[model samples]
Target chain A: MRSKVWVGMVLLMVALLMISGCAKKAVRTDGDVSQAGQDAAALEAEKARRAAEIEAARLAAERDAKRLAEEARLREARNQFMNEHIYFEFDSAALTPTAVSVLKEKGAWLDKERAVNVLIEGHCDERGTNEYNLALGERRAQSAKAFLVDMGISPSRLSTVSYGEERPLDPGQNEAAWAKNRRAQFVVE
Target chain B: MNFSDNFLGGRVRRWRRGFLVLGSLLALAVAVCPSASAADYGYIDLTNPYLRKIPLAIPDFKSVSGDPATVELAREGARLASQTLDFTGYFSIINPGAFLVDPKTMGVTETDVDFKAWTGIGSELLITGLASLSGGVVDLELRLFDTVKQERLLGKRYTARQADLPRLIRRFCSEVLMLLTGNPGPFESQIVFVSGGNGQKEIYTCDFDGGNPQAFTRHGNISLAPSWSTDGLWISYTSYQRGRPDLYIRHRLENRGAVVAEKGINLNGQWVPGRFELAATLSFSGDEEIYLLSGGGKIIKRLTQQPDIDVSPTFSPDGGRMAFVSKRSGSPQIYVMDMGSGHTERLTFEGPYNTQPSWSPKGGRIAYTAMEKNRIDIRMIEIETRRIVQLTQGSGDNESPSWSPDGSLIAFSSTREGPSRIYVMTSFGTDQRRLLSLPGAQSQPDWSPNGIQ
Candidate 1:
């Protein structure tokens, strides 16, 4: 009866040792699973931050390109306005009907752009004396200015200068070149 | 006096027929003897259309001093004098290679000149010079001889620094011209013009013969309509240097300038004949008008009240009248106004366009540009007789005529050679020749008054 009791105590000790070893193995496995889950969450957060940074960079580049294109468009529009010249008859400062129509368009533009100041450069054909041509050019510019003012553009926003026969648009001495030369040009200030 | 007395007596005898005959004789006499009676010196018939250029001989000058520099200068002086006289178009220089008399043996005195030798070479006039150099100064004695008359016409001596040889030679030549013609030569004068080709117009000046071209203004901008002050110490022009069309006066010698008038469109500024005042076209009143301003550009008087353009006011030599261009008649025409009485009258009526009126220094005629047949040419009008003379025709747009101070020649700009160039011609529009062959086109030439210094 004493030997039977000693064998029962050894069996109880073996069972208790097996239960403790199983419980330790289960805790180590759970710790490793939680650590791996925390590492995956950190990597996912890093990847989302990189994607957000790339998207922000792409948006900035698009904004810059749009701004540049808008600037070029504005420059082209301004150039069109500046390039519109009013031509005159040879040795005469009197504005033609065509010149009046062109000036009307310029006046409308000027009226809308009140903040922009302009300079009217009066030019003449290379036919007369420089002094008299200067006077004629001034008269041409004044005529254009008057037309614009009559169309409701402010006089203070405009100034006139005469280049006389000194500056020719076309260097040819023919009538076609002269017709192109006798003009009133615009400059934005 | 003997010739005039005989002529007048003969005219009085011929005039006894009637008052009309007397009038005609008087007119003829006056016309024939106007310049001859004014001076005792022999005169050339400049008005004769068939008049020949006077044959003049200038041999190599004699070196009075033993210095080598003096010998070199003597040779240069003779050459310069010949060149200056030749440019006048009134004298033809005889070749030195054809000279019969040795100039070294001949002296600068009438007694020392062999008049027979000079007359033998078809020379009507002779010039002899003797030069001596000492201490960086040259003493030159010049004598002009009427070889045909075997008399000394003029004798003068000048002493100056080495660098002043050109001036000395010019002054002596001017004296020679004064003795022959009633007016001095334009050799000492300068021409102020606008030259452009480098994308900017700049004011430039050259000698009367188009030598020694120098930039008068280096503003690197558009500078135009240069006019010399009466004293020739200043030049007034319109420049865009200050970013606007303003009138600026520059000192020709000091290399300094100032904006004289910045009013609305200060276009053309010309000095009054004897005063420091300027007559310019200013649009300060909202319309272009001629105005008289002080040398500093202070407005002294408003010369015109026209609603149209009144520009390019040129003062009469006496300053009692002003001639300018006006558009009050529907086209540009020249108008003259009396300063004292304020009486204005239109001076041009023949052409549809008449502008750039430069009143003659002699005070009776006005030179201007007239447009016809889509081409422009130069024309002049007489104030008294209302006679209009066309000076140029079919010459490819000749304009901007400025008379030489003596009124013997007119310097203008023309595009006859494909590019605008400055040209000079006689008052009658003879001998039209290019003034300068510069790199770029040049225009608006104003000849300075003679004897600037």
Candidate 2:
């Protein structure tokens, strides 16, 4: 009887040990799968972060390029306006046809911009009396102002003044200087 | 008590005392005198060529009404004339009470009046007048007599409102000066000067008396040396508007202008007569030289042979001769040249520097700036005799003397006020006054032609 009882106890102990070993293997497998799932989630999150960073950089570059292009266009327009001068005829307060054309083009540009206030400066050649020349200069400025107003620019936006014989475009006493002096200059304020 | 006898007795006593005092003083001074028989005439020796004053007598004009108000008006007119002449620094008006003749007794038509009376009173010139209120206006008849010459020099009738008596008196006095000195008066001329407003020197026009000034050039550019055209229609000036010194002409009536010349320094331009020629200083030849240009901006001839500085040319009334300042003689001096022959003659001596020669309209003399003995002054040179009469003295750099149309006075620029201001004085260097009291520095005063009515 005692021998049979010992055999039963040993068999029970062996069965219980095998069952605990299987449970341990199942728990180890569950931990490894959970850790692998966490690693995969971290990798996918890193990929999404990198994609978002690239997209932000690309948008910033596009915005910078757009701003530079706009600035370039503005610079070109300003340069064109700055380089053009209004010329006049000899001893004439009246504007020449070419001066009228240039003024028209400038007026169109100003129309597009609408916020620009210009100063019309009347100049004269160094050949007349100072008092009389001043009066002539005022007429030249008025001539330019009249044209600008006719082209739809508001009269208040234009200011006319005579430099008289004070300001000359050329310092020579030759025809070249008189030609340069007979002009109305447009300046952006 | 007899009041008249008592007053007479008192006056006799005072006179006796005054005579005793005067006698003793005279005796004491005569003991030390260089001559024992020196007369007691109150006269000052004018040994210096630059005399402080030439004694003159301008008495109250005899009024017809003899009313106190009329008398006062006549006295005021005479006083105005005296002040005007005195301001010219050439005349020292003697008081009538200091002499024997009463100013009330003198008349403008009394040509037989004793010049000995004025000479006895040590007056070199005697001016007398009569004023009458007729037709609701003041009619004044003035007479100027050279007591030394013993002849009447000026006689004129002027009619003006009673209120304008002061100005009329000044104008009449200036005319008298022209008759005596042979130069035009600057009283009625105009000057164009530059003033700083809004950070730029703008051109402004004012009367030679510094009245009725108006701003003409408003462009914010540096204005310099605004010269008048002979016709008074245009002004040629150099402006920095184009970033270089360019020549420009401003027309009078149209308020329009044009560039006359360019590409170098074109400056100091004066219009030649008939609106056909312009004389200007051009630096196009790498240095400043006088160039003659057609009215339409074509170079006709070069006035100066050397590339030295030759500027500020003023033509005679007939345009036959031009007076210019040249630096060829190692210093700036006035030179007169025949416009047709180009024959140059030096007109100034006794000064290291002389510039800004202005030919008198009558062609008798040239007015210019002269530096003498470390002092800059205005001097007039007789064209034929080369006699230089210094018109100004002291430590002021009086420059740019412009002759009046009638050759009586000169309008000039001086830097006595820390900045340049225009001044008018007699050709004798008297009666200087500040004209055109505008803000900023005003200089380069050019008198206009006769704008008289």
Candidate 3:
């Protein structure tokens, strides 16, 4: 996001510089030998300068709009990567098709952002023993990491941890809360 | 002390546990309990499936000095004695109010007598004691008698600094337990458990009777799965103090420690019996597997190579074998591995979710938690016969079953009464009761040998 904003600012500055250069060109044209001819030339330069400033302003606005749109898209993707947890069924670490698709989308984003690394945290519901759930949580994390690695993300870039039942996305005791809790989550590094 | 020695005559009895000698005092108990000593195997057979709960009476302890200080000390001693014995679940403590004779006037000797009154109250056994306090020191003389046989079973006189009154009562209880069950009761033991609601849990320990509950770790981080080192000087637990589930091996007293902050999860540390070595689950290899670690948290060897998760390894009392939870069999189930040969066998067949296997200190049995239809209960498995016995009825989730040092009882965390709390029951699934009550929730009780030096 920072890089995109930097690019947008750089483009805006370039457009401002172009508009100022067009005005300078118009000023240089004003000192011609014939007054009438020079006035016409100045008039022509002003028309061109006005057109250039208008075009520059339009270009800057377009660039800013594109940058904002791209940023919103990136924000959504990152939010999806972090917030859209790959859920697992109770007492299981196996990935369903839905989980696989989520991992694949995350994989694509990871592919684009080469330098980014992540920690995959596995969590469990409040059932079962805490100690065993810890292992189950780890397995869920590993399965998610493996899916990402299989999708071409470097294994070195993906680390894993198990929170067992200590953490819950939903603290309620019902199935809905439990379904939200039995998941593998991501933290970007 | 001399009279105690004469009554407690005999040599030490050695067992596989190496026995808790407790200096010459415990050594002096053998010559005592003439009626009980004749049956050296112990008056109570703990492993007997049909073992009946002994109906024991603990009347008020007499104050020799009869002053307020001595009187208070005597009353406190009797209360502590009765509470600790009742915790073992081997004794059904008869209410003191039922005694026909006032405990204030009862004598410690068999002749001070009212044996008929005790028998009439259906008390199979009786514990009578007296306390004398002088100059910040207390001397307690306690005796256990068989009401039906009209015989003095065990007697001991313990002297200690006044503040050590609890220790005096605990020691006497140990003596009574030795005569009755052969093994000293869990009175000398401390239970380490995770205490805190939700986040930032810490390791807390209390006496066997839920006395002196204090924080063992002040990490102010999420710490889980604490187990005691064999000698009780060190504690091994997994702490995320550094933002990872790393194994921490710290001394129970002084600020000394070791760490195995491996690449991935380093968790569920279990100390080998009578050794500084421990077994823990590590995922540094990108898969969670059990590995042996030195006391200082250095890796020794990998114990499991299953394709799936293998964790929560509990070693047998002899350290010859380990039973752990593994998903190699498709679901979480208990699996026993021969530590010597590295041969592993699945232990439970009926439950799809059976975990937290605790190897009893005695032998052959492993107690574990089983979950069905979202409810969890504690169950035990016999090694040779593959016998499965449920130790807890399903109520709220009963999880993380841990065995006491004596193996006569099992401790675990239960959510039966709303918020979770630590609880214990007889090994045969009787006398279920909450072990302690604290402000916050507590779970994962690991009963260790005496933790204080």
Candidate 4:
């Protein structure tokens, strides 16, 4: 802190000397003028070096912030892939038009991010028996996978599982909840 | 609550706290009118199923050595025997308050029970138990006496450790049921089921009548569809422990097992009766198809060729035929395929959705779940006659019908009281009662024959 203050003071003093030298050229001695000129040159070099260092630190900080933001954005993208589900009708695994659109987006995302692998989980409403629901859930998951493969995602990168009615997205025993529970969910592996 | 405590017509006074505690289990104490054939002592009419529950009397058990510990055992033994017998949906227990004589003055033998005292109280049969404890071992003798004829129908003696009293009593109950029903009842059996919800499900097993329920798998992940091997040694189930559905065949007692973690879903692993192999739904072939897998989970052969979903394979008692659910005909229906010829035929035509076919051990009927007006119920289809009998009705969906080892009872799961729980009823759907209550819902019950080693 003291050195920076000293440097500022020196620069101010040199500026005053130059201003005075310009105004009173006849009163200044030759040796005094030469010393001031030498000091000015060295001060110019120090100022340039400090400006360069400040610019480098600013660029470095900006790059680091950009990298962190990109990482967070990728994490959010993965989360969106896991949460967007393809829903089905009662006791049926046939994909709806809305479900197909959602799978289309999923396929595009998977295609853009080639390094991703996912496990598609098939689920069911609490209406059917667990054994049948398990099989139905698997069928639903396979339905989603088939559509994604049709949209150009590698079948190898996509796996499937069936939670049956074991894990319900909504525990409510109503129509709305049952509709929500009968879905195909994605889990990034 | 003393005289008419049991709808079966008999109850003992002060059998202990456990009696009153378990006495509430008289939920199944059905009002079977007294049988008219009480004169035919030692004879059971198999043709007349669901006959009146035999009016029975069980006196307080006595200790031979008069040891305090043995006396406690005797009391518990009597209560347990009576409770187990009551669970058979037989023996309307007669009240001991109406007994003409005290049990302490009589020996636990056919000759000691006074015929006039019991016959006068409407007791058709009676059970007398005696216990003796020595060096941490208990000697128990239980006898079933025909009070009408004043003759003993069955008698057995067993010596076991203190903790094994339930097993000993079950052995005696099996004897009693053997003599009465021809086939021993489910007293010697156990039920494996799925319990727990809210994103976690695990496998559980309990003795018949819902005693000693404990978690069979600690996977802490979603485990569904537990199938007990007919040999009573292995339990096959599907667990999500490895993050994907895999079929796990684990020994009931040992610490070793095999897993089929094939590429896609490995749904339900059902063991072939009396064989070292199992059938499971594997999707590695790009579609859900049933395949025969070795007991160690090695794929032996693909059993089904279909573009539609075909899963849940159940073999007949003789392994000559396999029954399963398929969507080959545009809707979910059950189909049976002869194992020898691989010829498949649709066994159900009444459904837009019919699945979960459980082949009865008796080999003539296959019990399955059917949907009627959006409500699920258990229905049995006789193979030869194509007679479908609706076994469950008017309760919150009752599905997953598993036949007891004797085929006289069907154990299933229902949501009649809200959360799904295990329940049992006669094959005729009479005397419906909750089997057990656990934290979280229970489903997918599979009964094993002779739960004891």
Candidate 5:
């Protein structure tokens, strides 16, 4: 019976030791899981920072592209407005009916764009003397300017210049080319 | 004739004695025969084109200093003299290869000339020259002789720097022409015109024979309508240098130029004869009109008050009247306005497009370019009778007719060869030839009035 009692006490001690070992392993495992969770949270925060940087860079690139597109569009619009010129007959400063119609369009545009100033350049064909052409070109420019002023455009916002036969849009010595060169061009300042 | 004989030296006097003896015999023979007296003096008709050209012999010039460089220059001088005379279309040069006398052994003095040899080669005139170089100066002595009469026509000596050789030659040629035609040659003058390509036009001046072309204005802009002052010391032209059509006068010898007129559209300024006043087209009054401006760019007076385009004013030789283009008749036409009375008269009525009227120096006619059959041609009209004469026809678009200083030839621009280039022709449209073969197209040639003395 006494031996039986000692054996029971030894078995109880072994049980206590086994239970303590299990409790310690459980505590260590819980600490390891909490550390792993903190590491994963740090990794997640780093990923969020990287994603934010990428998003910012993309937005900036998109804004630059959009700005350049807008600038090109404005430039093209200005060119289109200036491309329309008023033409005249050979050695005549009288504005044709078609030329007056075109000038009306230009006048309307000038009315809307009040801040824009322009120069009216008069040109002539190579048919006459350079000096005479210069005088004729001046008359053509003045004629155009007068029509624009008559159409309610401010004369101060418009200036006149005569290029004469010095500058020709077509350098060919032909009737068709001369008809193209005899024109009044518009330049935005 | 007797004065020239007295100017002869010793050996020349000896030859003159022999010539006099022969001349006396011929005179005696002519006195006996009435028909022989008709051939005594050789007179060339200036208006006759069917006459034979005077044959001239120009031997190699002698180098008095015996220097190699002087020798080369002497030969060149002789060659240039021959070329100058040949270009006048009044003389035919006798080839040196056909010479019977040795040029080296022949002395430059008139007595040393073998008149028989020159006469044998069908030369009516003989030229002998002597050149010497000393201290960077070249001295030349030239003499012209009538081979048939054995008389010295001209004797002159010129001394200048070696660089002035061409001028010396031209002066001698002018003297020769004066002796022949009673009018001094225009070879010493210059021509100013517009020349450019690739959208850059500039004013250029060249020798009358199209030698030594130089750009006078490098404004990097349009410069045109160059006109010379009566003295040729200044050139007035229209320039866009300051971004407007204005007038500028360039002092050719001083190498400086200034804007003379900056008022609105100061284009085509022409100098009035014997005056510092300029007649130019100005648009300051909101219309093209002619105005008189002083040399200082001051507006002296307004010449035209027409409500149409009036430009390209050219003064008469007397400065009493002005001929210009006016569009008051619904088309460009030539008009004349008396400067004193301001009474204007229409001068052109035939051509629909008559412009660039250049008043002749003779004050009898006005030459201009007219449009005909869809092509431009040069034509002239008499100021008094209104008789029209077509100076150029079937040539590619001839325009801008300018008269020579002597009014014997017309210098105009034509596109006959390809590009518009300066051309020259007689008053009757003969001997049409290109004036310049420059790299770019040249136009609007205005001959200088005369050599700047």
Candidate 6:
């Protein structure tokens, strides 16, 4: 009877040991699955941060290019107004309708830019006395300035000078040369 | 010697002639009955200053020998000599038809020449010349005799080409004038200026009396205010070719030119002795300043470093002094500068604006433009004498008076018409005439020497 009771106790201890070992193995597998999920979450966060940085860099480059293009366009427009020279008639200080039209265009440009100063240079052909031609040239320049003043430009932004017969556009003593000489020109400062 | 009341270019011819004839008869009656009183001083004063025009007789010229060309040249010489003395307004030419001694009978070299016949024909001065052409060259021998003194005043012989007969004549005439009045003749000289109206402003040159107008420059740029060198071979002018103003030297002999003031604004350059220094209005400093530059384009000196407008500088005949127009006085006025001392003196005080001063070659007179009311006229100021002579009386805006080398005429630009034209007049401002008819305008007349030859 004593030998039979000892075998029973040993069998019971082995069964308990097997049950504990199975539970421990199941817990280890669950830990492994949790570690794999945490690694996937870390990789996804890194990919999202890199994508956002690239989008911001591309937007900045596009904005810089657009600003450069805008600056170039302004420069070209300013040059167009300054490059042209205005012409006038022989012995006539009166501005023609065509000259007025041109001035209007110039006024529009000035209004848009608002930083340029216009210089009205009064010039005459080499026909008249120097003193008289000087006076005539002044009159022509004043006339042009008056036109500009009437066009809503500030009078303070304009200046006039008369070269008289001392300056001629054409050195030839012919009708063609005189016609070219009788004029007032515009310069921007 | 109140001869007649009739003159050319006058009005009321018949009425004035009758009135003057009646008045002259009454004055003669009164003169016979007048006592030597203060009221009679007027008649006596007029009689005391009895200056009469001296009579001269010019023959067709006596040719003793030489080829046809030689004879032709001799006659031309005599004709030119006669014309020169006659234009002085001092001598009168006796009619050739009134000659008592025929040239065919009496020789020009006669020692016992009959002075009685010439005197009776109202001749006080006599000119004779003989010309010979050989090897395509002309040898001209001329003689001038004061008939009253019966002494030869001049006996000059010259050699030139056959084509130079006219010029030779003019020179001989000028010599006679020099002997009579210590002043040289301006006939052989030229006038340079600018003309406009037809459609262009071109520099034109002509004789002192507005004859032989010729155009010299044809740059598309504006050309004006041509000043001549003492030799008249080179012209200093302002040109606007590089879009900026610059001075240019044009050599008529070489037919070549270059910009002397290349980098700065240069206007109205006149020549000085031994150097090409000019008084130019420069903008190198961003404002118009007067600078003195060497002929080689070196900035030798700066006359005015201020910012006011200064232009139109004329050097005195001696080149020791200069007269220029300056606006430092708040308006344009004539100013004089002494070169040695670098001192300046204001010369003009009359007009609201007096500019474009041209110093006479005699160094005595300053010709400038003075404002008259609203018009401008040419005026003269005698430096030593302080004598003011108002030259022009026209309504045209006259400016830029360029005196002849001989100081007998002035060429200026006027705006009497719609455009400016070049005009020549006596220094006294009596005779006026236009030189160009091109529909385009012309201005700035500068006289050259006998350079075309």
What tens digits encode model 6's per-residue C-alpha lDDT throughout B321-417? 8877766776677888898887988888876777778887756778888775556677777776445666665657787788767665677777777
Candidate 5 chain A weakest ten by summed lDDT: A72-81
Q: What is candidate 3's lDDT per residue for B165-281, written digit by digit as tens? A: 777677778777776656786888889999987588999998886778999888888998999987888888988899888888888888999988888788866889988899999
Query: What's the true lDDT of residue B363 in model 2?
Result: 69
TM-score of each: 0.80, 0.57, 0.85, 0.80, 0.79, 0.64
Highest-scoring model, TM-score: 3
TM-score of 4: 0.80
- Residue B30 lDDT in model 4? 20
Global lDDT for candidate 2?
Answer: 0.67
Candidate 2 versus truth, CA RMSD in Å, comes to 16.0
lDDT of 1 by residue, B252-317 (tens): 898676675554688865789988888888886778888888877788989899899888999889
B-chain TM-score, candidate 3: 0.88
| Residue lDDT tens for model 2, A1-189 | 998888888887777777787788888899989998999999999988888888888888888888898788877776677667788765466677888888888888889878888877778885533433444565677778888899999987887556666667676667788888888888788
* Candidate 5, residue B407: lDDT: 66
Candidate 3: which docking quality band? acceptable
Query: What lDDT does the true structure give each of the candidates?
Result: 0.80, 0.67, 0.81, 0.81, 0.80, 0.65
What does candidate 4's lDDT look like per residue over B357-453, in tens digits? 9988877888999986788888877776566667777889989999888877889999999999999987656678998999998989998987453
Worst ten in a row by lDDT for model 2 chain B = B1-10
- Cα lDDT tens digits, model 5, A26-107, are 9989988999899999889988888888888888888888888977866766776699888899989999999999888888
CAPRI quality level assigned to candidate 5 from its DockQ score: acceptable
Chain A accuracy as TM-score for every candidate: 0.67, 0.68, 0.79, 0.76, 0.64, 0.60
lDDT over C-alpha atoms for residue B161 of model 5:
84
The DockQ score of candidate 1 comes to 0.41
Model 3's i-RMS, to one decimal, reads 1.2
Can you give the lDDT of residue A86 in candidate 3? 89
Q: Write the per-residue lDDT of candidate 5 for residues B1-453, one digit (tens) a residue.
A: 001112323343444444455435432432232222223112211232312457899999888877899999999999999987776655678999999887767855667788888899898989998889987788888887888877776777788888888888888888766665545667778889999877778999988777789998899988889898887888898888887788887788786756754545888767898887778888878888998987656789999999988999998999999999999999888999999999999999985788888888767778888875578888877787676767677769898888778666688999999998999876656667898878878998998876753
* Per-residue lDDT of model 6, residues A1-189, tens digit only: 887788877777777777777788788779879987887888888777777777777777777777777777776666666655456765456788887887787778778767789777777875534543554565577777788889898988887666775667677777788777787777787
- List candidate 3 stretches off by more than 4 Å: A1-48, B1-52, B450-453
Retained native contacts per candidate, as fractions?
0.51, 0.02, 0.76, 0.62, 0.47, 0.04
Error of 2 at A134 (Å): 20
The C-alpha stretches of model 4 lying farther than 4 A from their native spots are A1-80, B1-48, B65-68, B451-453
